[model samples]
Target: MDMVQSNQLEIRHISPEVRKLIKMYADVNNCTQSEMLERMILEWDSQQSQSERPPGDEDE
Candidate 1:
């Protein structure tokens, strides 16, 4: 996948627990925080689209 040029996203309201989880996940996966976030967002988007599909439309 190609990287898109975009403005930075500054999240200022995350909880400490969530921050720790993100850091831990990034460490375990050996990826930077930004990479982890992008991967997670893409996976979530894919899951959302799949859930929105009709019962018999999965084979398309």
Candidate 2:
């Protein structure tokens, strides 16, 4: 795999409780910690993008 195709993502400043939650969810979901974080970030981005669109902006 090319390095450019898979970039690193550094997440900082999270509380210990959040860190433990991530680990627990990752284990329950059968994915790595990084994968769980990616899922969370992507879901948040999708929701924000939908909310930011103008009224009646439904996709065809």
Candidate 3:
């Protein structure tokens, strides 16, 4: 269990409502709060890069 292999992070606070929602969803899916957040960030990282845009971008 080395520190380098761990998924460490720092997150800012959110409203109570959002916190409750996150907890509820995590409970239903049987995952920790941090785990759910990590999954979301990974999914975002999987998106296409800026240079790989589709056609019809010459006007910009």
Candidate 4:
């Protein structure tokens, strides 16, 4: 048997109208919805970790 680690994900179904809206955003950004979503999550994570720094560190 083999096992693989995975990031937990929540999935939901949305109406066609909502999907169209999401598609518009994705197209404007030149990215797929999943790509956009992943980017968003990464951005949020980076923002949350931005305050963590060692002493003597200064913005360059």
Q: Could you tell which candidate, 1 or 2, scores higher by lDDT?
A: 2
Residues 1-60, candidate 4, lDDT per residue (tens digit)? Answer: 111111113213556685577668779999776555556567778977776766567755
lDDT computed for candidate 3? 0.62
| 27 Cα displacement, candidate 3 (Å) | 0.5
* Cand. 1 TM to true fold: 0.74
Worst 10 residues of 1 by lDDT: 3-12
Candidate 1 segments exceeding 4 Å error? 1-8
Q: How many steric overlaps does candidate 4 have?
A: 0
What does each candidate score in C-alpha RMSD? 3.3, 3.7, 6.0, 6.1
Pairs clashing in candidate 2? none
Point out where model 4 deviates above 4 Å: 1-22, 52-60
Q: Candidate 1, residues 1-60: lDDT per residue as tens digits?
A: 233112015323556787678778989999866666667778899999989989987677
lDDT of each: 0.67, 0.73, 0.62, 0.58
Ranked by lDDT from best down, the candidates are: 2, 1, 3, 4
RMSD of 2: 3.7
Candidate 2, residues 1-57, lDDT tens digits: the string is 432223224434566798789889989999877777778877889999989999876
TM-scores for all predictions? 0.74, 0.74, 0.52, 0.51
Candidate 3 on 12-31: residue-level lDDT in tens? 45567866776787798898
Best by TM-score: 2
